[model samples]
Target: MQQSNTYIIVFTAILTIILGGLLSLANQGLKPMQDKSIEIDTKKQILGAVVDVSEMSNQQILDYYNGTIKSIVVDYNGELIETDEKGSPIVAEEVNIPKNFKQQPEDRQYPVFIYHAEGNDDAVEAYILPMYGTGLWGPIWGYVALETDLNTIKGAVFDHETETPGLGARITEKEVQQRFENKQIYDENGNLESVYMLKGESNPESALDEHHINGMSGATITGKGLSDMLKSYFSYYQGYIEKVKSEKSVASL
Candidate 1:
């Protein structure tokens, strides 16, 4: 027996509705897990800049992040921004870096994360700056932790969306990042010279001088991108940095 046109239309509509509802419910169920994973990964990246997080579990990362790290948002002039224009409180971790990167520099929100060693909440071990830039194939970003002097690199950790695996992707390697440790970002005149990378392989002793590191053997473009990102962010945070330095100088008087 042949079905009537109206019956076929009605059955198709019912199937479509049921399928759509199931899809929506599935998405709702998965959202929380996705958000949680993102949060844990972000915490790991931030913490990795100041300390070793490779051996940490997910819960450990969360606990250490909540317990030892403090963060604040600042504006272009490096003045603290307590709240958004609508009066809601601003959070450093919640600041969207790529979104802010699209906005004008003076209009963007900068997040500064301060790290405190375990058992000492009153002392700041390092100041971590978030950095973003363009790589050979995609976006690259990282966190750089500066020592209490705010001029010496305490540590660094970088990531990229898509770059040549063996060449530019090496930026995410621990050894490559360690190359930046203790490298000074200031010149003798107290100027913020920042740091750069040479074109090819070199030893740590030869790399750390006034302000340069050894670039990956075949990744000069990505290397330049890294240097540019650091210098640009450092200049952006110069206001806050100078303020801190001034206060410290006064305290020593």
Candidate 2:
């Protein structure tokens, strides 16, 4: 009996080792494909803000993103951050927005994606800004693309990790996102009030509408959360936006 027990233990140990090694090798082999998939998905989300990417293939999205968009990383003070402490150049797409949002709002770095017109280096069509915050159930994030004026929202795309189905999750739909089109972020007094979604329903037809969007019918909290995110991120990006506006003004003059 003792001899049999020893044999069982040895067999189990060897089997465990073999399985672990197999898993490690599998992971190593799959990582590159996984990373490329993630890259394509991220590009789709980013470009979906300004263009219709649903009909686009992965390679097309990659080509469009590479050809049409340029990105930059800016500090809380709105100054461009070109390199890290180790001297590796910082990349906007590589910035971990959710992790950065964990810090104080004033301490977070912002990523801006500039969308340029085809074949024209001098004409910028829009500036895309990424936003991150909590939703009713989990984390929510998206991109908002502003027109060259830097105040009007040209388009937006939002997604949540685990929001309720048919309610808060509706934020991921194009209908909800399109509501943000042409909305102004700054008020007449030059205050960055951000955009709000009223509870109950959308009031886009109201004459008084400027900074307000129609709220999700049954997802008031999610709507508010989205509004808060916009407000917070817009404030964080305000300095950079102001700098661009100043430069454009000078260029026009």
Candidate 3:
């Protein structure tokens, strides 16, 4: 009995050590690949937020992103300043093109992608910006675009957490996304209305305007959270948007 017990203990210890060593080796070996995968996925998500997935495949998306996007770092006030340009602080730089812009609070730069499609005339669209927020169960992120007026939503795409599967996750569904198509982000009076995920069902009568939409049933929290996220990010882009609008207005005049 004593010999058997000793043998069992020794076997257990040996197995534990072997498994631990293997796990450590695996992590070390996979770290670089894991990081690369994450980077690629990030690029893919950003692209999805900007472009129609049906329009491009994985490799095509990568190729288009590399070709069309130009990153620049800017300040909270939307001033384009070179962080690493002069001998100034290396902290104020933001990516203007296809770079990560999550450095400082009130001093971060965001990505802006341009997509050119051949339509009747040459149709040029700018993928305005992206923002991240907390959802009911996990993190929620989206990309919103603006028209030349900077008040209209050219397009948008959202993704979320575990949620309630068919309920909360519906924010990323095709039917729900279609609700935001061609919608204006602001009211006729230039109020920051964003987009509303209406409760129950969408009623054209109660919409903020012709562009407002109804929220999904059983997913009120997720819908509301998404609207709030849009509002907050729009605040960040207010300066930039205003500048663009002003420039266009001046051009028109």
Candidate 4:
């Protein structure tokens, strides 16, 4: 009996080490692939915000993505610079600007990407900047694409934390994301009016009649959090946006 018990203990110890080592090895081997997948997914999401995704298959999306998307890094003055694939500055501290940009809005990199839809040079579209923030549980991130006006939001995509699985997590769903499609971001007078998240069955027409989206019903907190996140980052781009608007106005005249 003693020998049997000793054998059982030895077997358990060996099994534990073997399982741990296997897990460690798997994590090490999969890390690069996992990161690559995430980067691809992020790029896909950013592109999706600018183009129609339903019309193309995954591979076609990727092919068009590789062929058309030109990523560039811009400084506070909106001047382009050579940078990483993510559009961050090559300088170490310069890249760190976005992390604390809410306090020092003038020091952000301002990533920009231009896409030529359907391989047509005439159909070029631009997406600017990416946003990340804390949701109720974990991290929430999104991409916002601005129209040439820079006031009108061309499209937006949002993903979020580990809130109540089906309820709060719905903020990340496709249907909810679709609500921002072609949503106007400014009043008719062209003032900078950001989108808002309404509560308690608030109809957009009645509540935000001029320019805002109705908030998610049960996930109002998430909706408000998203609004807050936008206000923070969008304000940073104000100078650049105003310059674009001024250029458009001048061209029209």
- Who wins the lDDT comparison? 1
Kindly provide the TM-score of model 2 when superposed on the true structure, using C-alpha atoms.
Answer: 0.88
Q: Please, what are the lDDT tens digits per residue for candidate 4 over residues 1-253?
A: 3578889999999999999999999999999989777666766777777776667766776787777776656655655556766975474213433364554556566666665665664455665557766667766777788876576677878777576676667767777776776776667886667777676446746566535777777777777778777776676566556666676689789
lDDT of each: 0.92, 0.90, 0.67, 0.68
**lDDT ranking, high to low:** 1, 2, 4, 3
The residue-by-residue lDDT of candidate 1 on 1-253, one tens digit each, is 9999999999999999999999999999999998999999998999999889999999999999988898989898878999999999998999999999998888999999999977576688999999898889999999999999999999999999998999999999999999899989889999999999888887568555769888999899999999999999899989889988998999989
lDDT of 2 by residue, 1-253 (tens): 3568889999999999999999999999999999999889888999998999999999999998988988998887778989878999989999999999889977777899989986565679999999998889999999999998888999999999999999999999999999899999998888898888888674547733768878888998999899999998999999899888898899889
RMSD of each: 3.8, 3.2, 4.7, 4.4
Give me the runs in candidate 1 sitting further than 4 Å from their true place.
1-27, 203-208
How many residue pairs clash in each candidate at the backbone level? Answer: 0, 1, 13, 1
Error of 3 at 177 (Å): 1.7
Backbone clash tally (model 3): 13
For candidate 1, give the lDDT: 0.92
| Clashing pairs for predicted structure model 1, backbone only | none
True-vs-predicted CA distance for residue 235, candidate 1, Å: 0.6
Worst lDDT 10-window in candidate 3: 91-100
Better of 1 and 3 by lDDT: 1
